[model samples]
Target chain A: MDETILKTEEQDFIEEDICVAENLVYHKPKTLTDTDLHYCPGCGHGVVHRLLMEVVEEMNIQDKVIGVAPVGCAVFAYNYMDIDMQEAAHGRATAVATGIIRVLPDKLVFTYQGDGDLAAIGTAETIHTCNRGENILIVFINNAVYGMTSGQMAPTTLPGMVTTTSPFGRDVKTMGYPLKITDLVAQLPGTYYVTRQAVNNAGNVRKAKKAIQKAFQFLQQRKGTCFIEIVSNCPSNWKMTPVESNKFVEEVMIPNYPLGDLKVPKEEQK
Target chain B: MGELRLMKGNEALAEAAIRSGCDAYFGYPITPQSEVLEYLSREAFNRTGMIVLQAESEVASINMIYGAAGAGKRAMTSSSSPGISLMQEGISYIAAAELPCLIVNVSRGGPGLGTIQPSQGDYFQATKGGGHGDYKLIVLAPSSVQEMADFVRLGFDLADKYRNPVMILADGAIGQMMEKVELFEQLPRGGTYSKPWATTGKTKDRERNIITSLHIDPRQMEKINLRLQKKYKEIQEKEVRYETFKIEDADYILTAFGLGARICKKVVEIGREKGYKLGLIRPITLFPFPFKVYSEIAEKVKGILDVEMNAGQMVEDVKLSVNGKTRVEFYGRMGGIIPTPEEILEYFENKFLKGE
Candidate 1:
């Protein structure tokens, strides 16, 4: 049995590509390799991870980038990214990034956060950090549900979406409403660029990579905070298969929270 | 090398932190210690681009320190009693992560919004564990404005030596009162002591380093604790610092720290003039406790008078250090009331001299 497993693992490794291509650019993704990812199958987090690494390699910022890992499902981001990373307390990635950027102003600093981690527990930290006009990039992953803790409703969960806590469908009368962070943060003058994108398909994935690259580039230009909110799918938490999750994201999530650039300064506008 | 200048204790501490080449200052305004923040704010931007941030709250100030220290910068924060209590969680996190930084606590009356007068009620919190955890801060108790200035520099050096958080424990009297002081020369900035372990940026040649206190395995935590204990033991050997006065050939010794020690100094002077052999053991490093010196003195002294602003905190440590080798007694004034040297002398005359 051990011999058979090793043979199949080797075959799978051979099948997996050593490099990735996006927008007519070929880049080597970091060695995510045979280490079984802790993410649930068909989760959007893995796709986001691959896209980010591809950007890191393509822009050749792998050496100059510092990643602030959140305490959500992405807590184990250190295991995937080959670049320098630090794990922050729940919802404190921005505060930690503020410190990092203040000390090493030249380095590119970015934080990866989830809806619950960023919008719920870390709301004050996130808001104050943006308000401070910290020269850092923020890649916010809004999956609308808590994936790691097993199907819990997050602050960005759409209205009427049900979870373990909001079992009978999130009641607008009691649970308030889903949060639109991009729209809220975009109102602040300190923000250099704020955009909301999705990752349900290859085309959206391409757009996300471009947005992330641009955000990093803006930070390199000494512009203010650049935030990219990536609307993502959580199949395991949504209790739907991979394909159904993508369909739900397009048909439900996009309509309530439309995807587009919510804010871009005239100087930063392309 | 120069003439003495009359300065508030808080101002002295500010000058000392600057001279020590401190990289950043993050603080919120509180009474009795507000001048420390004010002085730092004025000079911070001029000298080598020192970062001084007037944070929104005591909570934000300490968290900012956490961030700066994580980047391997020598940062500090100052606050009074109530504000210090609010910073306990951040302090514990800094201690657990073993980050080097300085915290100044100008104590006032406490146990919930007491007077702004001087008080040693924070003795237990400062000497023992103030925050939740099995950890200790390298606490320095300064008796005078001169010591306040001197200890700020020493606190930074000690923190760097042990890679641990250090606290300069003062009170409203030491913080508010003005006294003569001789300032030291400033240390050169842009030295070679850079934290290579800090998470500044990711480069291709290095793997990303993560700074965290979370440990899932119990055994792993135990190993970490043991490592911390070993480091603390080393500190005990090398960093135990104190001052002794009139102790040789004395029949009795006065054990005190901070302002209490200053009052005790006066008591010792007058007690000796009256032909009673009274000495003093003033602990500069409260965490190290100067146990060896006190243990040795126990063999020669008849008893120890543990004087403090609180009812009885350091007396417990004095008693433990004496270990029944000598009789240990205590005298205290609480709730923001400071005891003068004359009152302490009268206590010695009435409590020990008259009784004996």
Candidate 2:
């Protein structure tokens, strides 16, 4: 058993290397831990996690920001994000975040949730948390499917889309129209910054990263709830290759769910 | 000792929580227990920096406690039967996560919205794992307004000591009744221990703290279960609490808890007045039940009467403890009914002495 123990280099134990400095233009963010993420190739969860942690690192608030992980595919987000985190029950991330922020109002708090966890089972908590204008950031991942559950129909699944639960193709009339919860929350007075972005491409990734940065900055300013919804893709669950998934995200998903800032605070208010 | 005041059980509990220097309270309005939320709303913030928020629902309130407990804070919530039923999912998560917090159940009649009146119908749900999975909640039954005031501090201490959820199981009778209580002096916030493993954010000196109940591997899950079981076994050994009266020379033993115990005290006196020697045993810690006393006393007593306000709930535990050494009879009311001492004494006499 002792021989079977495979010890790897502990975080930059090989940092004094002679040949590795010049060629590297960018490196992994310090906010991300060394643990391998379990997300599949081309999965948007990994990118979002990276972007969120990158923002946490850039803002120098890595020691102050506490995250709440959701119950969907990102349930193990704490393992990768290298921040103090509490794993929420399915759809209760916002409520859990509320608890943390209320107890220690000085700490920066945020929650990362998927569509099923956020828009479906946790709809009440989400609406009320936003309505209360909880002074925290909310990162919503709308992948249109329950990726962890192998492509079940989520509340954001498009009309006529075929999923495991809606195998015969989702009927908008029977299955209920695909929910645009971001649009609904944007209308609420509690939201200080509400935006929708995608990470299916390089440009989109940069924009999403900026949204995350502003979300944290707004939270630091003690603004009301900062909600950012990301249009993402599921490759394995979508039964498509990584490239095909990205293409599908652009051609099909983007048209259905347009990406832009839905609600922004007034310039004078900031 | 702090100043004494006449207070309702729910109000006393809320006031005690404030004095205990609790960090936050997340609660919802429920009958027989709404005063707890109301009292805290009026007093918690101004007295100390304690946070008081009326959550969206019982489900939200319990998860809020979970979040607060994860961060190593003293947080609590109170609700009645139906609301508690709604909180089962979050309670199960908190239990599995091994987070310490307090939950008060001002119990009422259940089985699908039975009544708003006090009932002990939640015994099986409280003592037995009310939620899913194999978990035992440390249950403290408060019988009076004074105990209600005292148990808030005790519950928080026990929770932090074991890093497990502790529940104060009171009922509508206790929650609504008014009695003079000598409150304890105010303690500092966050209680006795400094939780090093709390998810309070990662600093440069320590690794990140992750508060989660998820263990996808079967072996890891089994190990978590075993750890919880070991902790529970230790609690069973060290935390068994009960109060016994006149057991030195009695032939009959009367077993009850909370209000049942208070009523049984009267029944014991009534029986003693009628030339019958009777004793009473009230279990304070219901989960780490005084199983040894019940089993040992079974040898000396001629019979035991289990009194409750539900359909033979706690009687099952009593019967199991007695294990056929002596007759264990049960007499109780259901659907928010409380039997008088005369009624209980008559039933005992008819069953044991008259052999009816």
Candidate 3:
């Protein structure tokens, strides 16, 4: 074996080739536009949207997918997704998905919901749809605070967290504790996969993409309800900058709500 | 061609739905209307792939209907008094979206969770807007099991014809009573029944479509309202259906619908036997309200007797259609108490015969 040393020009060429190969291999999704997004400057919805579009393109299911948009900040998500999309009433996306799937069984169905939509007024629809074993994917964004409604306390707001509705720091005696939707849905036998991931760092973002991919695969297999709850950060609602919001998510939200798979199929474990 | 069978009105409605190529049904179990859910549940998954779901609540069931209708498939739901109230929001959404679906309201006593018995209390709710917004459901009032089956088919056709919701405003009496009905065969699926505007899936040939009612611009909303009104006008002119009784040279015309219409038939016979010049006008389509027939009768007859099971709801419609040309009198019984034919004849005897 002969050891070879690379020249400076060769090293530069290798770096340039790596960059070109990366562009060819992991191309950006065409579903998104370069125009400025409507989200706040440091909002996590943009990241989630990009990740979802990448999954849609990678799976090559864009033509056959239908997204049920929610009523909050993501109400206009239909404008971004290239697939067929429907906007549902504030908390009735699951019900709408049930209708669509029952009619068009071969198409992929997914819903993007915030914590308030999934855990509050739409609790019955969300829980019952999962219990009924509807073959659909649910991407629940748990930001611990309501962003669209001007910084109100969401159902996932932790104790001691302050919000418009919880000015006294979410009094446990009066406001009750935060809701754990992933854990609650994990108990149902109809749910095939249930996981919680965050988006505060690159490692967690990679983990979130994997979780989303698995959820979509589960749906493709006609397995039951696959739910991926992302503990997103709302820097605008938290009254912090982007970096500070990521730090708060890493330091505070993860401790109160630990991240990991709460439920998974036994056969897939090994 | 089929065999004649004795079936309850609710059961007949369920069978009619299956026969009319209804692919999906979402409903919650409620009193006086549970037979519909039961029958659909038993037969929905058998021959063709019919989706019958017992939703968590009436609200969820109607939203499911909204979803199914949005996909451009034949869908339906059924409920009674209190449950129909819960479905108002979803109904409004369905109407606003302009999706073709069927809804059945088996009326009972109301104002709240009233008793589950026969009453004509939901006339205003069905013919007028049950839900919010300026919308109309093509209201068909079926008096018997035969009409119940017939109207289900007619309701679906009219819904698709006008691209709007159609309702079969039956009552607890019609829902519970059994009658002989000739059942029709199921229409073959995937024939000529695909909606191009439905949210099936994105295809390269067409741009993405959205089914929504939110128009922020005042002028655009007005244009949409104008188009909807034009559709309603066309429906009114083309889809008016009714049954006429002996009204030539008659002095009084009795008008009613659903079970009340059946009772009015008997009242006509009793009044004829009693030598009273009383005819009958049975409205099959309640929203259209048989106005032309009423206008003719208003010119020919001396007065009109508007009979119902509730405290005078359809009387308002009768009066409006008559347009003050003829005197319209109302006789009603509330809280699930049905009016007997003799009671109505007696009312005619006292209020019209002796008073005249």
TM-score of each: 0.89, 0.96, 0.93
- In candidate 2, how many Å is residue B84 off? 0.8
Candidate 3 chain B, run of 10 with poorest lDDT: B186-195
Cα lDDT, all candidates = 0.84, 0.92, 0.87
- Number of colliding residue pairs in model 1: 3
Ten-residue region with minimum lDDT total, candidate 3 chain A: A1-10
Q: Which rank order by DockQ, best down to worst? A: 2, 3, 1
Candidate 1: residue A130 Cα off by (Å): 1.1
lDDT of 1 by residue, B229-345 (tens): 898888888899999998988899998999998888888988889888999999999997889998999998888898999889998998898899988888999998888888888
User: How much is B107 displaced in model 3, in angstroms?
Assistant: 1.9
Which ten residues in a row are the worst by lDDT in model 2 chain B?
Answer: B347-356
Q: For candidate 2, lDDT tens digit of each residue in B68-124?
A: 999899999999999999999899899999999999999998789889999999998
lDDT of residue B160 for candidate 2: 93
Better of 1 and 3 by DockQ: 3
lDDT of 2: 0.92
Q: lDDT winner among the candidates? A: 2
Q: Over the stretch B1-356, how does candidate 3's per-residue lDDT look in tens digits?
A: 68699999999999888888888999999999999999989986796778899999998899889888888888999999899999998888888889999999988888798899888889999888988888888999989999889998888888887779999999988999999999988875422455888888778788776777766679999998888888888888888888878877688999988888888989988888888877888888888777889887898887899899988998887888899998888898999898899999989888765655
Q: Please compute DockQ, using alpha carbons, for every candidate against the native two-chain complex.
A: 0.51, 0.73, 0.60
Which has the greatest TM-score? 2
